[model samples]
Target: MSTSAPPDAPPALRARHLRKQFPGVVANEDVSLTLRAGTVHAIVGENGAGKSTLMKLLYGMHRPDSGEIHLDGEPVRFTSPREAIAAGLGMVHQHFMLADNLSVLENVVLGAEPGRAGVLDLPAATRRVEELCANLGVRVHPHAETGGLSVADRQRVEIVKALYRGARILILDEPTAVLVPQEVERLFVSLDRLRTRGLSILFISHKLDEVLAVADDVTVIRRGVTVADSLQANEVSSRELAHLMIGAELVRTERPAHPADQTARRVALGLEEVSLRLSDGRQALDAVCLDVGEGEVVGIAGVEGNGQTELIECAAGLRRPDHGTLTLFGRNITGTTLRRRRADGVALVPEDRHRQALLLEAPVWENRMLGRQSAPPNSRRGWLTRRAARRDTEHLMRDYDVRARDADVAAASLSGGNQQKLVIGRELAAEPKVLLAAHPTRGVDIAAQQQIWRRIEEAAAAGAGVLLVSADLDELLSRSDRLLVMLRGRIVAQVDPRRTSTEELGVAMSGAGESAR
Candidate 1:
């Protein structure tokens, strides 16, 4: 399945014998690859399989212990990211870094200003940004504040920033991990356009369906080495890729068949006329209404930034709705503090794990005690109990399969999957009557995702009402008894997962289908 170019034309980029080692592990070893010109190349691997390390080495974020990189058939050494950019290499990292208060135009041209004099040139930069946006078919406001833009728009701005620097080869890391099906389609279209214009792309993603749909060729990595370097994208399937990543077939848990009666079950959560206006003066939520019954899973599926985050925050008591009444188990909890809501048997697995869920600087045991300081095991009579906390942390580590050296280690030392495991484990340990889960399995490996889903399913089976918010449509369909679609801050449709398809969900998510109630 190898498709290397003929001997006459050189590759757009090439790397040989890359080796990088950390204190306790060999992150990468003897990895070599090639990116043919005017083609989309993909690197696929599970989390902690050295995908990010390899990309960092290529982008000059870290120098390899041993390796060589060549651009246009000539050897080149990039000492810094700036050097890589000057050599026509640009990378959009998985985590976005944008100044919230700054205008989109300012953030785009922050480091790469155009004018020669010391005085800044706003008009020139705006025009250049507008032109780039048009060429890429990305719709974004140049004058709007960065904080007001959606996650998809911010990602487009990041790409426009890279293109403004004259990048001929672009690297995108886990680009579609946060996007819904519709937004993923738009991104694929943009990538295809870039390839048509003769630009080389190196895409990094674990989503195999996207890899097959968007890439011309694929490379699979496992255990810090390239397992298959020349697999043609069209010849591979997601099942095959999963097997390659884990060296075994993926196992799926069987969901229980007992359908809970929506009317007979006790109501665990009730929201009525929930509307929210964001700080930027935009309508984030539009009179949304939903109800979750005990022992039921109600899933909210939509494109990112379609008020999913806002909805979760309002439910978690982090944000106050401009208009709505929130009740838990027939008790009105509107305008209540998060702690009071938590004490009332409410728990949240937030969307942004790093920013919202756990404290990175704390030990694993302390993180396990987070959000539950008012309860027992971690605390007794308003006093923190170290021994009990440590004991429970060890139990969670073993049960949740958090791969850490010890519970005494910092939470920051763990991988993304492990961090997510800790968060889910801690949240579920609270034994809340209602769970608000937002992208709980995002950025995790396939195995980790399975485990998380199993935990959520168990919680729901035990009569815990779950509000599952996810960009993954398959996850929603598999776990949700009922599915609700959100578009432009409004709940546009509701359907049973057993009778719906991803195609129908995609249309409803994009607001192009008939509204179902």
Candidate 2:
């Protein structure tokens, strides 16, 4: 492990011969990367290819078994994330980490509150945060509560928090995954402003098109090692990069054509004026009415925090709506348990796989066996069937392209995208009549995304109704026959995807004008 760059005018950050080994997996093996000063550098790879591992090593979440990290031409070792931050490095995680009850100003200056003589200086902290936001062209109120802000606004607060701490090098992981197309454009604009001010950015994303669009240099890693390093961003196309990632040509995604006869099929899922009151007494959903026929895909498009979670919970039987009715295949299931809903051929793919869908510490087989304990193969007469569960897990791992050494591996060891695949695979294997897919392809690689979409289409073709909730406009526009727009806990507009544009959908989502309900 040695630095390759010349000592004069050292790079902002560099890693040489980095290696990290887990129990049964080598997360990174002899990986090296360099980020020049004042540039946006991107790392791209398929899921479970050690992209997150490498970033964690750099961020000091995990120490490499063997490697040398260099900052400004000097060897360095960080014992914790705090040391990394003190060294002018900051990381914005894929999932935001702000406290919901706190205000924007408090969240920004949480660890580094300004004070004198044990007295907190609120006005000074607010002024500094406001200045940082103004510099970055982000619009956010310091007094506003974190829980009520939109996803895009919360992301801006994260970025401003990093800048407020005097970070010279920033790490952003999958920043645009939850944002609409318009919000992505705004993020790129802020990144450009930061880059011009001599800040170095390390961007980790599964989206090739976005990497190519925003990065100054691109690096590709495969199988826990660097295959391509410091390639000029303009020299490679997304197609070539995709091929390098998976060792094959990229698969194109096209929506399957719905049968004309299926248009009048039985309703698999129906919501009549569904309204919900959250535990915190918020009106999360209000008078939401929708229906998905058998063999049809109905998409819901909205900015995050706009009643999607409540709607999914209502459909999945995780929560009982305060008013209105929910029906599964013409059966009213408003008062049923979650297990009973699943027994009635209802399956759900939750938005946050780690929180709602997976047992992180459990083995893959055990995780696959969850929620089906009362059914055949998984269990019989309340007795577990280990052999049958193992067989099914192996098949799902192979079919879903979940990269892992074996079914005995812990679910937490796999990458985010792989975890998502396992959750979806388990739900789909039940052959449910109705599927609740919330951000199904949010963090997955291109190859896995295509596979997931194909499976959804196949399920719909097999007479399963799908409620597709996604922030990706293209995903909704292409896969959905009818698109519903939600704003402020209400369904404001319903548009035909074939005739709608992204701009029009964005307008409807933002509630910029009167609704055409």
Candidate 3:
């Protein structure tokens, strides 16, 4: 029923009436889209709107209940990811899946290695990786340790890894979520090169302008159904696309005015000459000095790995600074443990929620009891009262608008945006005086972003000092009272977010402009 393909030439990939259902949920229903050869086709939708489900069906992560997938005009059924890969398909997840300790070449040839009699063919694999990287215009050090590369380079490596596996059609998920503006442009260039070389790309992202900029055609899906497809990217505005995404016009949340009386504010959290070193002996925080005032939102803008993680960890007592003084409400707490810090009204929504925040296999109620396990309403006399925890979890779910089957459901069952909301709800429930929020709304939909921003604003309006770190320049500029840019582990520049633009802030973040040094 899918036209199958144009009679003369075949599309790269096509899905028709795809329906996938999970326990207690219909993830995808009546979904259809086509990826033409040698084009960047974008798929845009809200979180839990069937985009991921459709991608999984295409990539063979999950089989569709009732659908037809035609590859290059030939009907195909992929039983697993291996089959998909064998048929010229590859998927790069939002999180990069490379071991830090391994070399780029090693990670690329890991599972699908060419060998003779159980011995690896290192020379042939290296040649193939280099050839693929060159063809795709990917600039990466194949022999270098994957950990030492920048986020952008690592992403390119992922792309090369996919190509090395003989992928002609690539699926990129939230590829720009972690990149700064400059790096984003670089990635766009690489995608263009790939497209020109006849590789199809199915781009998925919540960033509308980006989709409009790079995609040749756009598809919109909503609530397990496809409402629009094959719309020319140059013909439609982002606002119109957003309306299609959520089935209505998007409403911007009203933000509280930035506190004007800066001189009258009290120092809620202070870091004085904070210095920390990674286990690899890199200077993670080079004499960084910062302060957050009560009732103020101070935003930090930085490329990831430039001390943002270490600074937040130091504040939350997850890492010990080699030399520094951390003060909470004018009291030094450099030696405080994480539990004691949580008990004293300090909380964090970590950057990588899966690795640093949640216990994926655990029930929702237990995850809600994570950081604030010792706080009131969920704990009593050195023990967690399960009933109290479940009751609060239920309330938090409603309050934060987290979508899940039930409080007893596993946290892993929810979508990424819902998982993020769950983490934010749990941290904010404690009513902490000092809040360390990193990438608070990194990869959520517009509606969920509004809710999360509203909650953060509410917390700050109630006199909590918010130190927000995010790669999203717009979020930082719109939410922060003052913005500080980090470069090579140091606070190199401070800009007035109300006056400065994202481009200017991006220049500052990369240490290329506006320091006035």
Candidate 4:
């Protein structure tokens, strides 16, 4: 099945000599690429390397200061995203843009909704969505509430949303960041199906293996400049691509040596027979007992929505379980408030940074004081001080290598990777007894991921227990001393990270080897 376009065919999308500048920074300069029809063209770069800015310019979210954009070989200019969509371009942002309260059908037909003489045509939209999902082999019920869907299903809904709008080209940003190994395979299959139908995809990802796996073309950007363009993906190795992206030898994050054995170490976090029932009458968590000893890293692997979120929330004191005993250092803290947990040396890096960890409109300094407003440095003698907050913000930025003009700038202005770094630094700076991190390095590039891993391991080596939940099997295999598999609200397996293979772990996650413990 040859998906490549003929040599004589015009590119589905092309941008040449693209240049964009913002105050105090040049976001993208000299960026250019041609996305051939029926092929996946990948764009790779380090954080702040201008890939996002370039995509923005292409999607018409931000108009280029100077450049030429051609859609189907005709020069055009798009003033906004609406214009780009009208011109057959669609973009799926890293953070999904969907109303959780709505059904999948409602979310998909929201913008270009069908109408029969001023009346919403719900049936027509549902049929169309159903057809699109079937064609793409995406199994999502159109009428299902979006809030309850798995992460993979939500992503499928977003993709189908574009197709419903008649998009010929799609720009996917980190599409596989939160996907398991199996889910990643399914997504690639869907992308292949898209390619067969002559749709073009501009893939942006930090995972080099994914880019090499599915992309037909590769483009590299460094410091807002296009370092390389139109490199054939099949001819390039992951090592070669890594070098091109960062212009340095790629040193993959090396996991710190795992502490020898955990029998003697005291428990930092302990959960005994925990169970939770959601308001929807769904059993979100079965009686799950767990323990993380001081200086140990415990990794949880499961498909999204298989109770990982609930587990983390319960551990963080955001959710009160129906029946459970949560102990910190052998002391019951099951009913403790989130603030109490923090003060008791439990630090949490929540999964959703935007909703849980940060105020987008606030400056970096204010965000640094978010969870610890009453703690020392942030406050003294029960009074918060802006001066100390600002000082700490400066320190975190410097230490974490958060790229920003200054701490006074709004957090919304930093790149996603930088925002993630900021949040991790804010949490880790407390040096808590336990670190609860969920997908902490979701959207970051290679170098930033290394730094984050190093920090988390340093905390563990300092005798702080860490409970890590991630979709990245490699991270779990490398960083964790023990890995737990979750399925249908219960832990079904616990395997030694050093002994089990990722494929076996993926099977355990799916309930095949449910009792692999």
Candidate 5:
């Protein structure tokens, strides 16, 4: 399929010699980019390559150190996000910005609510949202509470909110990081429709295949500089794109599992007859069973909200399963507390890094010391040793290659990739026997993703049984020795990762395959 955007369109947005600098990092240095109307322009690069920083500058979240921004034929400068929005620019952040307590309509129209005489015009706002949804082919219930909706639904709400604000150019950051194959297709369809309506989109993604599939043009950035711009997607292959982004060959080495090596290794983690019921009485998990042996990497592949989160929570001791038997290292831990599980050597790289893994407002040192500050040399007699913590934080920062101004900087201030590295570093430093990694590499750049995969393999080689839950089929299949397909809270099939096709996995993930127990 041809990946290049239509060639004859005029430029809708343009940036010239953009520059941004933090304390120790020149985020963007003489970067230039142009977006054509009715096209999907993709920005591709490694974490800390200044892709996000450039986007932030364009969106008015951060003012450029030196740059010229032009909308259509007029030069412009935005001091804040509100000014950018007023100028027909909208940005859907990598992390969601919706209030869970609010209804979908309320979330879409937040801060710009329709009202008269201090009374909210709920009906009017809802009708407008309905019309917008229909026009964009965005499926969402306006009256539904945001908390009750799935990740994909929330993403749709974000899109609707941007369009509601009269945005002509939309920026989507890592839009497909959490979506399943089917949901990704639906999203692409919506983007295509929007393009047809003359909307320009700046799509940022780490997945090369997705970029090739939807992007009209591809831009590659390296070390805060634009290396390649407006490359026709069809003119280059995914492998070539990976090479361009990393400035080197990204070799995918595969190792065949030796069948004779599979012995009666001690069961490190076990789940039997696990069942969970939602608050609305819907069964999220239904008698699912799985086992992980020492030194084994068991991969769980499924679409988002298909009981993967519930199962992981049950195993992590975060949520009590209604009916299940969970064992860790031969000890029953079904009803155990999360702290107890942690003390028992259970480590987790949570799905939502910002919300569940790291404390955004806390300094990098504090986030690094979390869950392990009370152990060994860092704590004595219930008092945390600040010196020891700082030293350890420095070690992790250096070891993990986490780019930050300083250890004292707030976790939220770091880029998404750097935050992920910090989370992985902290969790892996504990050296637990059993590790639960959920979406461990989401939104990470190619180099970071490679590093994370290597770390997972290293942990498995060192005898730590790993359970990997991910939406990226290639990541799960390529790294894991065995793959278990989850559908509607049950294991539908088990297959050798090396042999399964993306098509077959998609079938299993969507519950469209022949019945197999």
Candidate 6:
């Protein structure tokens, strides 16, 4: 069903026949979308479905190969992001771009400062920023460093930055991917406020429920084509949206094992009374202890900033615990170097793939050869073998179904799902005895998510222990043999995955459930 706008209503933005193509891929093909003032428009699609490509076109990060863009009923073309911003279009990227060492006010006005002379007009900028924050109900510390803020707070700063630039149309890409349930609620509230103030919002997300809850209209894209447009949120169900995006029904598989007592076995990874303090002397991890056995997937579920990151870093030997013992295969490894841990068969797929997993500026083949360049065949006598690395990367790309043009292309050129596939492919090739996967499928499409699940299960079936940390409860419950809830820097409860409900898990993760003895 489509609702016609009022006679006086004008479209905030519209695109016609937008087309973009690379050598081997048609990134966006004759796609079109319309957005009206004060409405939340959502674009849903599988990864590589041209959602990001379409947004880049709209935001002027890339000029459309062939198309027309209209702003306020007039034909307009933008050559760059700055041009788009000047035309009242602003975008908040999935990965934030803020200076970690700078204050929030400074980061917000980094490019557009209010000053007549060389010196910055700090007072004017701060006042305007404070007013913007108040108007949007976005709470951000003006004097606080961007590095010291929480994920949610940092996102708010991004929103405020867009508003500060006089953006009438706002594009948010996967805004809720890193947020917990509570943070998501707050974000939705802010979006609603923006809508009320006659700001047009273009929301791109993989989470169907969030789209349904917040969007006024939904548009579905598949394989670079617009499959459905002007879809009313109330008229469609989540199941139908999933089918439209994935082109098939998603059959959620059950965890392989039933409840059983295998607690007596030698643990593959064990943490005993681990504690960690930050550089500023704040306690990040407090006496945390957990264990994962072979042939098992132990899930760590928590809201962000609940010490999950510190826990993962300590497990991977990237950070040392201030106190306590870390054992891998019954060997003390608390003070071991990261290289030593990796050599001891410890593999980590970090939460931030762009930062920790792959080198963005490097070629796919070079990335595939990382961490194993010292081994035989690929390298000898401190020399690199490009041919061998390329062949291996090509083979792994095919085996993992990474949809990329060539192995020589930069890793950053691939889509989010394909990048994740490359990371997983490279990490799994190590055949580690223990795998630490944090939000492995965070921004991937449904098909890629299924492939990742299969890979994780394959690892577990091969007697490799898995520690899975994610905010996605359905994914956690479906893949993990057992679930451990982390709250306030410690494990609060352990439950059989098959026996827990979403509500119960939420409560446990929030520290409202009975402690596990």
Off by over 4 Å in 4: 1-5, 121-123, 256-260, 380-384
Q: Clashes per prediction?
A: 0, 0, 0, 0, 1, 0
Q: What lDDT score belongs to each candidate, Candidate 1 first?
A: 0.86, 0.89, 0.89, 0.91, 0.88, 0.88
Model 3: runs farther than 4 Å from truth?
1-7, 254-256, 374-376, 380-384, 514-517
Candidate 2 Cα errors over 4 Å, as ranges = 1-8, 259-263, 512-514
Q: List model 1 lDDT by residue over 1-517, tens digit each.
A: 2333456788899988899987666878878888988889999877677888888898888899998999999998877999999999988887887888998899899999888776668799989999989878898999899987878888888999999898989999888988878788989988888888778899988677888999988888887888888688888888998888888899766555554545689989999999999887879999999999998889999888789999999999999999989999989898999998988889999998889998999999999889887677988998988998899899999999987767887888777778999999998988889999998888887877888888888888888999999988888888888889988899988987887888888888877843564
lDDT of 5 at 101: 95
lDDT of 6 by residue, 433-500 (tens): 99999999999877788888888788888888899999788888888877888877877788878889
Model 3 lDDT at residue 414: 84
lDDT score at residue 68, model 6, on the 0-100 scale: 92
Q: Mind giving the per-residue lDDT tens digits that candidate 3 earns over 376-403? A: 6778998878998898899999998888
Candidate 4 per-residue C-alpha lDDT over 1-517 given as tens digits, one digit per residue, 9 for 90 to 100: 5556788989999999999988767888899998999999999999989999999999999999998999989998999999999999999988899999999999999978899777888888888999999978999999999998888889999999999999999999999998888999999999999999889999999999999999999999988888889899999998998888778997876566654665789999999999999999989999999999999889999988889999999999999999989999999999999989998999999999999999999999998888778877889898988888898899899999998888898988888889999999988998889999999998999888988988998898899999999989988989988889989899989988878888998898888968564
**Pick by TM-score: 1 or 4, better one:** 4
Lowest summed lDDT across 10 adjacent residues in model 5 is found at: 1-10
Model 2, global lDDT: 0.89
RMSD of 5: 2.8
TM-score of each: 0.91, 0.95, 0.96, 0.96, 0.93, 0.93
